[model samples]
Target: MEKHGLRERKKQRTRHALIEAAVRLFEDQGYDQVTVAEIADAAEVSPRTFFLHFPAKEDVLLADADLRVDLALRAIAERDPAEPLAGVLVRAMDQMIAHAWDSDLPTGLAALRARLAASVPALQARLLQRYLTAQADLAQALLRAFPGRLDAITASALVGAMVGAVGAAALTALRRGDGPDEVRDAMRQATALVARSVT
Candidate 1:
C-alpha cells in the first residue's frame, strides 16, 4: 500500500510539473509558439512522458475542467436522493472550488488558460467541445441519481444552464482581470441564480 501510494504521488508530481511548465511557457512565449518538446524539457521530462499525461498541448489548459467534471459526477452520485437537483449542482460547484483551492496548481492557471483559449481559435473550439461533453456527462449522472424524477430533456437543460452560467461568469471575471477568488465568487453567484431559477 505504501509503495502504491508513493507511485501515485510521483505520478502526480510529474503531472503537476508538466502543467506548471506548460502554463509558464505558454504565458511567456504564447501558446502557439510553445512545442511539446519545449514543455517536456521545461518540466524535466521526455516528450513521451508528457504524452502519457496529456494527449496534446491544448489538453493542458483543459485538464482542470476535465477533472472537475469527474468530481461533479462523483458529487452527484454521493448526494442525498431527496435533495433538489439544483442544490446538488451547487454543492458540486462548491466542491470543485474547494478542490481547486486545495490543489497544488498555481492559483491563476485557470484564468490564464481561459485567456489563452479565448485568443486561440483551436483552443476555443476544444473548450466548447469539452463543455458539451461535460454537460452530457453531468446530465446523465443527474438522471441516474434522480431516477424517474427527470427526463433526458429536462436533465440536459438543467445541466446546460448550470454549465453555461458558470462558464460565462468565470469568463467575464477573467476578462475583467479579477483574481481567482473573484472569479470563483462570480461563478458562485451565477450558480446561485441558476439554482434559484430552477427551484
Candidate 2:
C-alpha cells in the first residue's frame, strides 16, 4: 500500500509538472506555436514522459475535469434524501463550482480556455465529450440516489436539464470575454435554473 501510494504521488507530480510546463509555453509563445516536445523540455521530462502524462495538449487543459463528476456525486450523497433533486443539484453545482474557483478565480481557467479555444480543435471535441460524460455520471448518481423509484428516462431528463443550464451559462461567460465575476454570475444563474427546473 505504501509503495502504491508513493507511485501515485510520483505520477501526480509528473502530471502536474507537465501541465505547468504546457501552460507556461502556451502563455509565452501561444498554444499554436508550442509543441509537446517543447513542453516536455520545459518540464525536464522526455517526450515519451509527456505522452505518458497527457495524450495531447488538450488533455492538460482538462486534467481535472473528471474530478468534478466525482465531487458532484459526493456532494449529492451528503444531501438529505428528502430534499428535492433540484435542491441536491443546486447544492452539488455550488460545491463543484467552489471547488474549481481557486483564489485565482476565473482568470486561470479563462486564460487556459482561451488558448485552447484558439489553438486546438481536439480540445473543443474533448470538452464536448467531457460534458456528456459528466451528464451521464450525474444521471447514474441520481438513479442510485432514488433507488428504483425514478425511472432511467426521468433521471436522464433531469440530468440533461441541469447539464444544459450549466453548459449554456458557461458558454455565455466564455462569450462575454471578461473576468471571473461574470463567469461566477453565469454559473450561479445556471445552478439556480437547475434548482428551479428540478423542483
Candidate 3:
C-alpha cells in the first residue's frame, strides 16, 4: 500500500512538472513555437514520459479539466435532492472556482490557456469539443439528479446556458487584459446570473 501510494505521488509530481513546464514555455515563447520535446526537457523528463501522461501537446493545456468535470459531477451527485437544479449547478460552479484558485498551477495559467485557445485554431477546436462533452456530462448528471423534474432537453439547455455564460464572461475578461481575480469575478457574476434566471 505504501509503495502504491508513493508511485501515485511520483506520477502526480511528474504530471504537475510537465504541465508547469508547458505553461511556462507556452506563455514565454507562444504555444505554437513550443515543441513537446522542449516541454519534456524543461520538466527534466524524456519525451516518451511526456507522451505517457498526455497524448499530445494540446492535451497538456486541458490536463486539469477532466478532474474539474469530475468534481462538478460529484457535486451534483452529492447535492440535496430537494434543492433546485439551479442551486445544485451554482454549488458545482462554486466548487470549481474554489478548485481553480487552489490548483498548484502558476497564477494566470487559466487566462493564458484561454488566450492560447483564442489564437490557436487547433486548440480552439479542441476546446470547443471538450466544452460540448462537458455540457453533455453536466446535463446528464442534472437529469439523473432531478429525474422527472427535468427532461433531457431542459437539462441540456440549462447546462448550455450556464457554460456559455461563464465561458463568455471569462473570455471577455481575458481579452480585456483583466487579472485572474477579475476573470474569476466575471465567472462568479455569470454563474449568479444563470442561477437567477433558472430559479
Candidate 4:
C-alpha cells in the first residue's frame, strides 16, 4: 500500500511539473509558439513520460480545463440519495469555485487556462467538447442519484441550468478582472439564483 501510494504521489508530481512548465512556456512565448518537447524539457521529464501523462499537446490544456468539471461530477455522483437536486448542484458548484482559486486567484493557473482557452481557437473547441461531455455526465449522475424522481429530460435541463448560470457568472468575473473573492461571490450568487429558480 505504501509503495502504491508513493508511486501515485510521484506520478502526480510529474504531471504537475509538466503542467507548470507548459503554463510558463505558454505565457512567455504564447500557446502557439510553445512545443511539447520544450514543455517536457522544462519539466525535467522525458518526452515519453509527458506522452504517458497526456496524449497530445492539446490534452494538457484540456486536463487543466476539466479539473472543475471532474470535481463537480464527483460531488454529484457521491451526493446523498435523499438530497434535493438543487442542494447537490449547489454543493458541486461550491467545490468548483474553491478549485477555481486554489492556486493564486486573480492570476492563477485556473485564470490563465480560462484566458488561453478564450483566445485560442483550438482550445475553445476542445473546451466545448469536454464541457458538453461534462454536462451529459452530470445529467446522468443526477438521474442515478435521484432515481425515479428525475427523468432524462428534466435531468438534462437541471444540469444545463446550473452549468449555464455558473459558467456565465464565472466568465463575466474573469472578463471583469475580478479577484478570487469576487469570482467566488459571483459563482455563489449564480448558484443561489439557480437554487431559487428551482425551489
Candidate 5:
C-alpha cells in the first residue's frame, strides 16, 4: 500500500508538471503552434508521459472543467436528502459556479477556449462531450441518491437540463462581456432557472 501510494503520488506530480508545461508553452506560443514533443521537453518528461496525463492537447487547457464532474456528484450527495433532486442540483451548481469564480482562471484560458472552438472542430466536439459525460455522471448520482424512485430517462433529462442551463448562462455572460460580477450574475440566473423547475 505504501508503494502504491508513492507510485500514485509520483504519477500525479509528473502529470501536473506536464500540464503546467503545456499551459506555459501554449500561452507563450499559442496552442496550435505548440506540439506534444515540445510540451514533453518543456516538462522534462517523455512524450509518452504527456499522453498519459492528457488524451489530447486541448484537454490540457480544459482538465479543470472535467474534474468538476466528480465534484458535482459529491456536492449532490452532500445535500439534504429531504430536498428534491432539482434543489440538490441547484445547490451543487451553486457550489460549482462559486468554485469556478474563485479559481481565477487566467484570462487566456477563456481566450484560448474561444480560439480553439473557432479553429478546431474537434475541440468543440470534445467540449460538448465533456458536458454530456457530466450529465450522465450527475444522472447516475441522482439515481443512486433516490434509489428506485427515479427512472433513468427522467434523471438524465433533469441532469441534462441543469447542465445545459449552467452552460447557457456561462456562454451568455461570456458573450456579453468579461467580469466576475457578470459571471456571478449569470450563475445566479442559471441556478434560479434550475430552482424554479424543482418539485
Candidate 6:
C-alpha cells in the first residue's frame, strides 16, 4: 500500500513536470514548433514517459479533459436515484464548469487553450475528437445510470444537446476573450437553457 501511494505520487509529479515544461516550451516556441521530444527533455523525462501521461501533444494544452469526463461520469453515477436525467446532466455540467472556472484570471489555461484552438489546426482537430469522444462516453455513463428509463437515442440526444450547449457557449465566450467569471456565467446560462428544454 505504501508502494502504491509512492508510485501514484511519482506519477503525479512526472505529469506536473511534463505539463509545466510543455506549457513553457509552447509559450516560448509556439505549439507547432515544440515537439514531444523537446517537451520530454525539458521535463527531464523520457519520450515514453510523456506518452504514458498523455496520448498526444495537444492533450497537454487541454489537460483538464480527463478530469471533466471523470467529474461528469461520477456526478451521473452518484446522483440521487429519484433525480431526473436532465437534472443529473445539468448537475454534472454545473460541477464541470465550476471546476474549470476555479477563479482563474483572464490569462489562464482556458484563455491559452482558446488562443491555441483558434490558431493551431492540430489543437482544433484534437478538440473536435475530444468532444465527440466525451459525448459518447457521457452518453454511455448516462445509459448505465438510468438503464430502463433511457434508450440509446434519447441518451445520445440528451447528452449531445447538453454537451453541445455548454461547448458552444463556453467556446463563444473563450473566443470573445471573456474572463473566468464571464465564461462561467455563459456556461451556467447554457446549462440552464438545456435543462429547461430537457425537463
Can you list the residue pairs that collide in candidate 4? Answer: none
RMSD (Å) of each candidate, 1 decimal: 1.6, 2.9, 1.6, 2.1, 3.2, 2.5
lDDT string for model 5 (1-199, tens) is 9999999999988877777787678778877789989989998998898888888887876767765766788887877868877678777787777766754233345545655676677778888788778788889888888888888998888887877887777766766666776766787798888778877
Error of 6 at 157 (Å): 1.6
Considering lDDT, which of the candidate structures 3 and 6 is the better prediction for this target? 3
Residue 190 CA error for candidate 5 (Å)?
1.0
Whole-model lDDT per candidate: 0.84, 0.77, 0.87, 0.83, 0.76, 0.86
Q: Write the per-residue lDDT of candidate 3 for residues 100-139, one digit (tens) a residue.
A: 7666223567777877886899898888889999999999
In model 2, the runs with Cα more than 4 Å from the true position are 1-13, 103-107
| lDDT by residue (tens digit), candidate 4, 30-135 | 9999989999999999999999999878788655547777888789889976787789989988887787667536445656767887788887887788789989
Q: Tell me the deviation in Å of residue 99 in model 5.
A: 3.5
lDDT of 6 by residue, 101-199 (tens): 862224376767777888899899998998889999989999999989899899999999998898889889988978789899999999999999875
lDDT of 2 by residue, 1-199 (tens): 9999999999988987887787778878977788889999999999999999777877777777777778898987777868877788887787767766652244365557745765578778888888888888888888888887678899889878877877678667766674677776788888886677564
Clashing pairs in 5: none
TM-score of every candidate relative to the true structure: 0.93, 0.82, 0.93, 0.88, 0.78, 0.86
The clash numbers for all candidates, in the given order, read 0, 0, 0, 0, 0, 0
- Better by TM-score, candidate 4 or 1: 1
- RMSD after Cα superposition, model 4: 2.1
Q: In model 2, what lDDT does residue 3 have?
A: 100
- Mark the 10 consecutive residues where model 1 has the least summed lDDT: 98-107
